[model samples]
Target: MPSTDDLKLRIEAAIPGSSAAVTDLTGTGDHFRATVVAPEFAELSRIEQHRRVYAVFGADIGGPIHALSLVTKAEA
Candidate 1:
């Protein structure tokens, strides 16, 4: 049961120069929605950007994290 702040911190730490706003969609700590902005995403495709974020969590994505919905953007 990860907190929103924890998820945000993990995403930011995993992706250098990135910021994440994470919300616990169900208040259960299993589902989340994250909007992340990063300079690194500027060159990557949407799928690639998502993959980068998801890679940070690995197996925990399905085990403890349940589902993570994402909206990613390149830094402007």
Candidate 2:
């Protein structure tokens, strides 16, 4: 089964120096919640920050991965 490792790697690749925490919201691969902190997020608005992370998966938002509740912040 595809695990968080795959998602983590993808996010890490999409945004370098980023750290993420993934939670299975429904015990299914679709619904998820992620807290992502990255140095690259500095100066970005909250909505923009979330968009950047969401864009990583492209159209997979409603496919392999479904709902992604994001808590994104710039790294301190």
Candidate 3:
């Protein structure tokens, strides 16, 4: 089970200049909701933005990370 801080670090590391806020939706560490803001998302579609975020976790999505709900935004 990955900690929320760990997940936030991974996301921020994976995407340069990005800010991620990860929360454990459940008491367990498997389910999460991440709100990410990045300049890279400016030109991408919502789906594409999500895909980029999801790519950071790779195989962990359905394995260690049972569920991840994402809310992404382009940097202001």
Candidate 4:
């Protein structure tokens, strides 16, 4: 299971000039919610922004990380 800080760092690292806040939705560490703000998202649609974030995790979305809820925003 990935830690919240780990997820945050991964998201930030994967998307340059991005900030991410990750929280474990459940105590189990498998469920998470993340809010990511990035300049890269500025021109992307909501689904595409989400897809970019999801791509960072790959198979981990269904494996070690059970669920991840995302709130993404373009940097203003």
Q: How would you encode candidate 4's per-residue C-alpha lDDT over 12-76 as one tens digit per residue?
A: 89999999999899889999999999998999999999999999999999999999999999964
Question: 2 or 3: which has the higher TM-score?
Answer: 3
Model 3 alpha-carbon drift over 4 Å, by segment: none
Q: For model 1, what is the C-alpha lDDT against the true structure? A: 0.95
lDDT for model 4, on a 0 to 1 scale?
A: 0.94
> What would the per-residue lDDT of candidate 2 be over residues 1-76, giving only the tens digit for each residue?
3467777778888898999888788887778888899997897999899999999989888878868889998974
Output the number of the lDDT-best candidate.
3
Candidate 3, 4-65: lDDT as tens digits: 99999999999989999999999799999999999999999999999999999999999999
lDDT of 3 at 68: 97
Clashes of each: 0, 0, 0, 0
The runs of at least 3 residues in candidate 1 whose Cα sits more than 4 Å from the true structure, single-residue gaps closed, are none
- For all predicted structures, in order, the TM-scores are 0.96, 0.89, 0.97, 0.96
TM-score of 4: 0.96
- Give the per-residue Cα lDDT of candidate 2 at 62: 84
Model 3: colliding residue pairs = none
Instruction: Give per-residue lDDT, candidate 3, residue 74.
Output: 96
lDDT rank, highest first? Answer: 3, 1, 4, 2
Model 1 Cα shift for residue 31 (angstroms): 0.3
Instruction: Write one digit per residue (lDDT tens) for candidate 1, span 1-76.
Output: 7999999999999999999999999999999999999999999999999999999999989999999999999974
